[model samples]
Target: MRQPLFVTALAATAIALAAAANLPEPSADIKAAVAASTRTPANLARDQYRHPAETLSFFGVKPTDTVVEIWPGGGWYTEILAPLTKGKGTYYAASPWPDGNKGVQNKQTADAATYGHVKFAAFPWAEGQPKVPDGTADVVLTFRNVHNWRMGYQRGGTDYSGEAFAQMFAMLKPGGTLGIVDHRLPESASDDREKSSGYIKVSTIRRLAEAAGFEFVGASEINANAKDTADWPKGVWTLPPSLSQKDVDREKYVAIGESDRMTLRFRKPR
Candidate 1:
């Protein structure tokens, strides 16, 4: 009787192990690329807002999927993605530096060399439509960049942000995923706060994406910062990096760290 019970328990453990093994793992090449890039101890200490392995997994990034990163500023995430998709999958960075912004263009050029298979596509924020092919990308990722569109930062008069969301939906294949991460403001917060604080109410973001014909899947609090009271006079930049109030409230700002972020996942209608 004891032997029979032990055998059953062993079989259950085997089944669990099998399931775990089937789970997707991040590429080692990607990890090495990130390690070799501009990511440093000081950068991690201040701009270490990334949620590591989980963020990639949530986006359903695999070694076999074509991925496009939108507005890959300074190639921060691009460093990890370019090599991951090398050889097996295509990794494309859309949008060159705007108006001869050499600082950003130089960064992209330096980072592009790390992977031989990587490609670049121009993404200009003009009045017309985006040029990304329809139903082409398996994943489209934009980080901390949506508010600019909402506030017409890219260009005046046109709400290119909503148009950008629609373009992403068009660029993704059926059942493909859209991953977004942005600074989060309180739900009760007003539009004035969004313009001033560099943070947007989560509901507004969700509404805009849904309006673009994508399905609202879910969100994660992996990057939540509890210390932020959401009442900094200078807004999100009042925290680290920007530290808008450097002289007046340096100590208070340093203690809060980065702004609270909202991580959201949306899916193109299949």
Candidate 2:
């Protein structure tokens, strides 16, 4: 299906503006890694909707760069990132205290066993938590986790989203890329109400990143779903995968498919 004219124009403008930027190009090795046999059929089925290759390319990911993935729940992207960075660079899975959660623990163990040399970083959810070393990473990526981080803004007794962005900024080397993918709310949406809705305004996200001292690079509509109305009984999770409402209007939600997402890239100033 052809994209809407506005989206196409935005992409074209971004490409033209960044024409001189030495963005990383995908290689045969990265392609082979993505197509590796270790991936499950169920996970592979979501590729059409996710467009991992194009998204990763947009973020300027390379084989030999230190990358940190924040809140890798279930390690969906980890499955691809581990192999791609295995022999050359480094991959760190950062999450908030994995010890208590059985699922997170199991994922960490399985990742260690399946992909040797994978590292773990403790995401600071509490006071006095050790931070990832300063200026250490080449790229930092987060997917669909921004809303969750926003939920912690006050609930966690601290500004969670603010601190998280600051941490990601401190961890990256000067000029490193920060890639984010999250369900996008309309520009007019209320910021306070965004937590329960599981969607965020692109402007709000930009404000947080800029507060943490990042320069907005560009955005992509690779994960945009025109069918999504962003107004559902169960918010963004009403759509597929989460299907939070269970059997209620399952077909309708499934037809609408995933939530429309904003793919944004930011850079730490050199």
Every model's Cα RMSD, please? 9.3, 6.7
Model 2, 1-270: lDDT tens per residue? 333454334334334433434434445555555565555556655765676666788888988999998888777787778778878999887777744223445655665655666677777545565446789999999999888878763356333788889889989999999999999998876776687788888998999999999999998877788888787887888998899999998998888888899999999999
Residue 13: error of model 2 in Å? 23
* lDDT (Cα atoms) of all candidates against the true structure: 0.69, 0.77
Flag regions of model 2 displaced more than 4 Å: 1-25, 100-113, 125-130, 153-159
RMSD of 1: 9.3
Q: Report the lDDT tens digits of candidate 1 across residue range 181-221.
A: 88888898677777656788888889888998989888777
TM-score of each: 0.79, 0.84
Q: Residue 95 deviation, candidate 2, in Å?
A: 0.3
